[model samples]
Target: MSIRRLMPGRAALRYGLIGPGTHAQENLLPALSVLDGARLTAVAARRPDAAAEAARRWGADLWTDDWTDLVDGEGTAEIDALIVAGSPQLHADVVPRALARGISVFVEKPPAPDTATLEKLAVDERGAPEGTVAFVGFNFPYGQSYRKLRDTLRAHGTVRTVDLRMVSAKPTSPVWGCATVTDSLLQGLGTHAVDLVLRELGGPDRVTARRADIGTDRHALHVLLEYADGRLATLLLGNYSNRLEYRCELVTDQSVVGVLDDFNTLTLSRPSRTPGVGVLDGKETLRHTWPGRRGGYGRTGYSTELESFHRSVLHGEPSDSPLSACLEVYRVLDEVRRQTGDRP
Candidate 1:
């Protein structure tokens, strides 16, 4: 559905934002403004200046440096949901309280600083109010190229192997190469890779990995994931790259496909079939490459994800980024850290 379809109603989804970082400023606020059915009711940030500035910019009714002013029911807006885009370490402290107050929440990935906190949250979310939904932000699965990749893999039979590669520079990399408190790359940024694998191939039976600290924070790493049926997947990540790059390749019985960059391109390869002879079937492969749309073709990943959360809160629909799913992603990251001997 288009953003216009969700406009101006008594049932509008009112929101209170808990962080005013670059992500919230550049993406979420703009996206939410377009989500006409959702109203920005309050703003809270660690800095008083940031909070007041966001409030003035959005015309929100309330602004505070303390998030409790929003979730504690002492704030001005009668919000139906809370968006927690604060530090990853604060999710454990913030999410549970939001749920307890019967307020739905949308949090960024790595839902907690560690597995122990996430485990408790998994339980808390399960018992939250009837319509309260909690979501984890892993937007790649919502991208157009990723969706096409998943569909192409389905038609080609089971995925036999996958190679996921991502590289980026320091200071600007997503999650900054690695998390300092937890699984580092395995959880902070690698959770997207893990979540993609889980959605397409179910859970892995075995996981192993190695980390390389090349000046950057464990700047490079290699990961191996083994499935119960003997399928294998590999992940490689680096933070010392001169520029940002992302590439993914999946191999199945009948075809191979690659999704590159921020999922803007798809490259497919399949065995060639000759009319008279089967000689070219295994010897040669036919390849096709096409550019995939990011935001123009329809709802972008960020828009769709926000719409998903809006629908859940307004219509009682289920969220794909539920606490359970977030926990599952964390579990894989926990395993990766354990295997690699990452410190808590």
Candidate 2:
């Protein structure tokens, strides 16, 4: 079916959330509340008290401790979509359940604990009725800086090499990491970096990853993704950092674009062919300060991504982050785990 035909002329789409935790508290829930044509219908948490509290805080009509009841309930009547932000271990079950009932799923990173589980989830995804879609919450891809940067790179030409770094403080809770070393850090956070690289250079032909235990079970990561088209992306992950940091540098034949962490600024520099020592800046160079697209650090980007998802699901179009993208992410993460010996 064509995506344009599924659009509902004038009605708000309802969404349900499974595992409404800190991320939900800080980002998703707040974002959903303000979006037009989208409603927060239900929320489920690990504990009933937390679920009830989130439901109340987020204005969800229903709160439950059991995810099965929420996802398996009547089809899209109470909830048009499901967001699985729970632990990776639980996603394998929750996402499949949601899809079986013909509901759209927006699952957070890692997808599952291990390759086999992720494979099972992929298999289940195939069985989902056509038009059913799933998304992994790789928020960085939808960022204003990233979107503009990616578009610029694609329009100019192929990206030959990319150097990326992602650093975050040790998670507040170890449950997020679970049994695996640095559990979801490399999978959850790394997923974002991987997705960006793939989006910029398509899928890679080979991926190699290594993990080191700095102090918090997982500390450092060195990943190399080689694309068949000769583009390469190198990822560096660090958790034992003082403050959160994200940096991406894309070097192409035309120019070099660098985006600083927190979307603070973007610098585009192209060296001149002149025989002088070097060119610091040129007339063609563009220095774009932060807040170029949206007001703050991705405040509007998240809203835009969610709104796009709502429109896509309602219109039966390709989801903002489709199931195929989710599968590729899982495939890359699985290979990373296999190389790093970080299976859960």
Global Cα lDDT for candidate 1? 0.73
Candidate 1 local lDDT, 89-169, one digit each (tens) = 677788998998788999877687766878889899988989889998777777656777777567566778888887666
Off by over 4 Å in 2: 1-11, 74-76, 171-178, 211-218, 274-285, 291-294, 297-300
lDDT per residue, candidate 2, 227-298, as tens digits? 777778999887777877888888775655555456666776666652222333454566666654454435
* RMSD of each candidate relative to the true structure: 5.0, 6.3
| Residue pairs whose backbone atoms clash in candidate 1 | none
Q: Total clashing residue pairs per candidate?
A: 0, 0
lDDT of each: 0.73, 0.73
> Ten consecutive residues with minimal summed lDDT in candidate 2?
274-283
What residue runs in model 1 are displaced by over 4 Å at the alpha carbon?
1-11, 171-183, 216-218, 274-300
